[model samples]
Target: MTFSIIGRCQESGQLGIAISSSSIAVGARCPWVRAGVGAVATQNVTLPALGPQILDLLETKQFDPQSALDHALGANDYSEYRQVTVIDTNGRTAFFSGKEALGIYTAVAGEQCVAAGNMLAGTHVIEAMVPAFQNTQGSLADRLLAAMHAAMTAGGEAGPVHSAALKIAGDPIWPIVDLRVDWADDDPIGQLDSLWQAYRPQMQDYVTRALNPTAAPSYGVPGNE
Candidate 1:
């Protein structure tokens, strides 16, 4: 009942993922990423545990994207009901879409990116995202956001979006930008874009402070000065 996209941008050495689903609070169900590890998007009978489970495998330092995905899928009996996409720090890509997954859903991968979605109008939704990421230039988060926009432009999921989110992390524990619209009007994708633009400055400002705390004093008063 939904169409969504998940991807990572390699240019910034940062990882970002965006998702939009027809179901209410889609962001809460899909999309996950970590710096230096990997990203996972599990949807269509979504299993939230896969988020951390995949991360844990990556943390072991023994598994790559393909191995990690295989192991994880193998452990679950309902694996056929879920769809997943993984992109590791080295840019290795992997994806699994269950046989029972909604029609029109598809996944595609490349050297620096992986795109996947279910309940879409057709395969083009995912096809447009890969090239868009390849040709786009900017921060990982920016490119990821663009990919989601492209998916929507290509006739998005077969249903309306109720929730959307974008997540990216690097060195820092917190995501560079983690924004989710749980429920919205008819145009959740556009709403997510507007919200991301509004929050980008603040998020960037936060990262600037995190990476260089000393620089904070220059942007504001010292000791209430």
Candidate 2:
């Protein structure tokens, strides 16, 4: 079982997803985002392909978030067994929870964001996340992490979550930030937060290195002396 949020930042046009689950390597299968297209979090008997499939519907077919989610998941006979959330570049949102969703599933949609979960401790997990994202001030990444933390505070899934992920699709062809704790017996969300902090300062440098290596930040190697 899993919980996730798909969000679109109005200020910078960034699309992102923050997710956690009892399953290992949840990042490899659940969260998906394309810089100029959208984001999808497919979990609860996740069909990993569905993540990109939803994004493809949004990109290639020019479908809005709702239309893309409808077209993509509706076609799958197993759709009812899954839970998903979507947010497109335009800040539109969509979500679905299958009839067969695990224990105590919940979904909450807010301005520019949508949160969903199955096998959750309570609906409050999703409820806590939406407002956390809406109320937090800072970059999209900041709000996303805040939402994930709040979900845990409100009591996450019915069981312990072993993995967590944060992914953001900014102006580049690649994800600007994609951090994950594939498996952590301890606090995966907190570990993910630490990774984000460590990576934040280098975010722009990585982009610059890709587009203009000469202008990228110093590596801080011994040669720098």
Candidate 3:
């Protein structure tokens, strides 16, 4: 019912996740990133806690992606129903897809990234995502969105994906980008793309507003008038 990619930008040292699913509010459950730590995507019969837990391991415990994933998966009684992907700050990646993960499951790992899907149209859904992310020339967020677009073009989930999310973490304590289409009967990916386009230019403005409101640009809203 879901497919996702977790990746790091080698040049900028940012981490992010792009995900979509037949389920609603997939953003709230599947993707997690810690600034200067790592990124995680927990899907299939998702254990949302696993996402943060893996990041905590990578950050606080100094565990590599594989070690963090192994520690987390080992403790779970229902590991077979879960699918997870992890990438550490150093771009080391690891992934696991349990035998019980529902229909057409696969996980593909590439330099600085991992893509995973379950209940997909085919393995190509994830296969297409990796190269798209690796080859796309842009910011980490742009590459992530491109990967999602590629996945959708490759046939996407076996059923309609109602929710989609893009989350990226840079140097800030909060995410540099966090966009979501909680539910849409059609094209959540397109909606997310539009959101990204609107956000890109203003992203630095948002950070500036947080750190120095007086120097920040105008709110540009009706209420400001």
Candidate 4:
């Protein structure tokens, strides 16, 4: 029901995740990232807690991606029904697709990224995502969006995906980019891409507003008017 990629940018040291699913609001549940730590995607039966659990292990406990995934999955009784992937700060990766994952589920790991999907048209859907992320240029968000497009080109979800999300964590305590189309009748990926484009130019303004409101530029909103 969902396909996603968790990746790290080697040049900028950013961690991000891009995901889409037949289900509504996949972003709220499946993807998690912590700056200077790692990223995690928990799908299939969808244990939302697993995403944070993995990140916490990586951030606080000093566990690598593989060990974090193993410890998290090992503690779950329903492990057989879950699918997850993790990428650490060092670009080390690990993944698991349980025995009970839905039709045509598979996972692929590339240089600094991992793509995984369940109830997909075919394994190639995930396969295409790896190179797309690896070869694409520009921001981590751009590469992630490219990977999502590649997945769709190969044969997206088994059914229409209503929701898509892009999340990136850079040097800040907060995410640099977090956009989502919670539910869309048409193309969620395109909608998400549009949101990124609109947000990109002002991405720094948002952080400026947070850290130094006096120094941030005015958006000329209703209150400012």
How far does residue 196 in candidate 3 sit from its true spot (Å)? 0.5
What TM-score fits each model?
0.89, 0.96, 0.97, 0.97
For model 3, give the 10-residue run with minimal summed lDDT: 216-225
Encode model 4's per-residue lDDT on 38-68: one tens digit a residue. 9999999899999888998998856888889
TM-score of 2: 0.96
lDDT of 3 by residue, 115-168 (tens): 999999999989999999999999999999999999999999999999999999
**Model 1 clashes, total count:** 0
Stretch of 10 with least lDDT, candidate 4: 216-225
The ten-residue window of minimal lDDT in model 2 covers: 216-225
Greater TM-score among 1 and 3 belongs to: 3
RMSD of 2: 2.1
Q: Residue 31 of candidate 3: its Cα lDDT? A: 93
In model 1, residue pairs whose N, Cα or C atoms come closer than 3 Å (at least 3 residues apart or on different chains), thus clashing, are none
Model 1 agreement with the true structure over 93-185: per-residue lDDT tens digits: 788999988877788886567888888888898889887777778777677778888888888888777778877777677777788888887
Evaluate model 3: give its lDDT.
0.93
Candidate 1 has its poorest 10 consecutive residues by lDDT at 216-225
